[model samples]
Target: MNLKGKNVLVTGSEGFIGSHLTEKLVEIGAKVTALVQYNSFNSWGWIDTFDKNIKENINIVTGDVREYDSVKRIVKGQDVVFHLAALIAIPYSYLSPMAYVKTNVQGTTNVLEACREYDVEKIIHTSTSETYGTALYVPIDEKHPLQGQSPYSASKIAADKMAESYYRSFNLPIATIRPFNTYGPRQSARAVIPTIISQVLAGKREIKLGSLSPTRDFNYVKDTAEAFIKIAESDKTIGEVINAGSNSEISIGDLAHKIIRIIGEDVKIICDKERIRPEKSEVNRLWADNTKIKQLTEWTPKYSLEEGLTETVDWIKNNMEYFKTDIYNV
Candidate 1:
């Protein structure tokens, strides 16, 4: 599954990770059609920030993944489909569970149907570490029993199962690419890394956060993007679920201090009750078992947590003017 000279379609191409993956595909000489969620303003999300060289090579398409006709139309004539469009915010999902079902579940169904119909060579369906809920054991692997502690995770679990059914029933050549806590530039404030950096850059001496006890396995965006390519290139990944992670773990309290240190700030961390999830819903810890992805594809995380956080802090510092740091972004 050589990507060079191939036609690729990346849904959610305007998102933090999707935009980077689009650029990487373009760099690999793949003709990429990027599907950005349509808006009245016609904004391309973070892709608008891409340099001319990267943007010119990509065929940008405006459409919603939840729309079957739109998804089918954009998926036509594509060799590989990277379906990443979904509602990702956990807080938003709690407020509107139906929206998550519509986008994450139904939207994924649309992409799978398109692939089955169009005879696309392969499809990489994006999954999240959230599906596994709080770690029941150390270094969670693909075999971990899924327990959806939030509406967002529940929807993703449904989406992942839907994709698996397609592979079993229709023999759709799809691989589920599950990534753990990917963070980097262009990340929204909904994510902890960006939230911490944005608040710190805003010159706040005190920062508000949710629970700090939970641990996460974070991966830099570039490493996750590269892992996607490696999975797509591997014949062994068909009908498989593979993880992309740094195989390292950190507690939120420790992670916040790490960011504070990187920003060179004397900040006080305050736990916001409103920001916290219900005790039953909170995922207490996550540690990725990267053995499957390592065995299936030659992919390794290139950036350490410190290195990635440094780059992320620099990005947030330079882009501080673009965000409304005073308001909590849900």
Candidate 2:
């Protein structure tokens, strides 16, 4: 499945990881149709920030994945479809559970059906590590039992199941890339790494944060993007749910401190009650067992935490205006 000159549709191309993946797809010479969520402002989000050459290579479409007609229209004539569109904020998901269900679950179904209808050569479905809540054992693998602790994770679980059913029932060429906590440039403040970076770069010494004990397996955004490409290129990945992670674990507290150290900032960590998840909803641990992806595809994390954090600090330092350091970005 060489993507070179192939018709590829990247839904949610305006988003953080989506934007990066879109860039990588373009780099690999894929004929990309980037689907940005239609808005009144006609904004392309991160795609607008791309250089002229990158933007020129893309066929940008304004559409919503939750709308079947919109997805169908965009999914048409595409050889490969990468479905990344979804409502990803955990706190926001708690406030509006139905929105998560509609956007994440229903939106994914729309992608599967459209891909099946279009006879797309391959369909790469985006997934999150949150689906394996509070990992029951170390180095969680694909076989780990899923526990949806948050509405956001539950929605993703439903979406993953939908993709699975499409693979089994419809025999659709679908693969799920379940990435861990991916962080890098263009990431919104809703994520912990961005929240810490945005505040520190905003000259805030007292960092307001949520529960810090929960450990996560963080992978660089670029690495995660490459994982998608690797999975898409491998025939063995069809109907597989593979984990893309660094095979390393770091607590939220440690991650924050690492970022602060990278920025050479003297910061105080404050556990802001408003930012904390409910006791029962917090996922206490996650460590990826990336053996499947490594064995199945030529994918390995290219950036270490320190290296990735340094790059993120540099990016957020210059792009501080995009974040509101004073507000808890739910």
Clashes of 1: 0
Pairs clashing within candidate 2:
none
Deviating ranges (above 4 Å) for candidate 1: none
> lDDT of candidate 1 vs native?
0.93
Candidate 2 lDDT over 1-330, as tens digits, reads 899999999998999999999999999999999999999998999999999999999999998989999999999999999999999999999899999999999999998999999899999999999999999998999999999999999999999999999999999999999999999999999999999988888888799999999999999999999999999999999999999998989999999998888888899999999999999999999999999999999799999999999888899888888999888889
Q: Give the C-alpha lDDT of model 2.
A: 0.94
| Each model's lDDT | 0.93, 0.94
Candidate 2, residue 315: Cα displacement in angstroms equals 0.5
TM-score for each model: 0.99, 0.99
Tell me, by lDDT, which candidate is best. Answer: 2
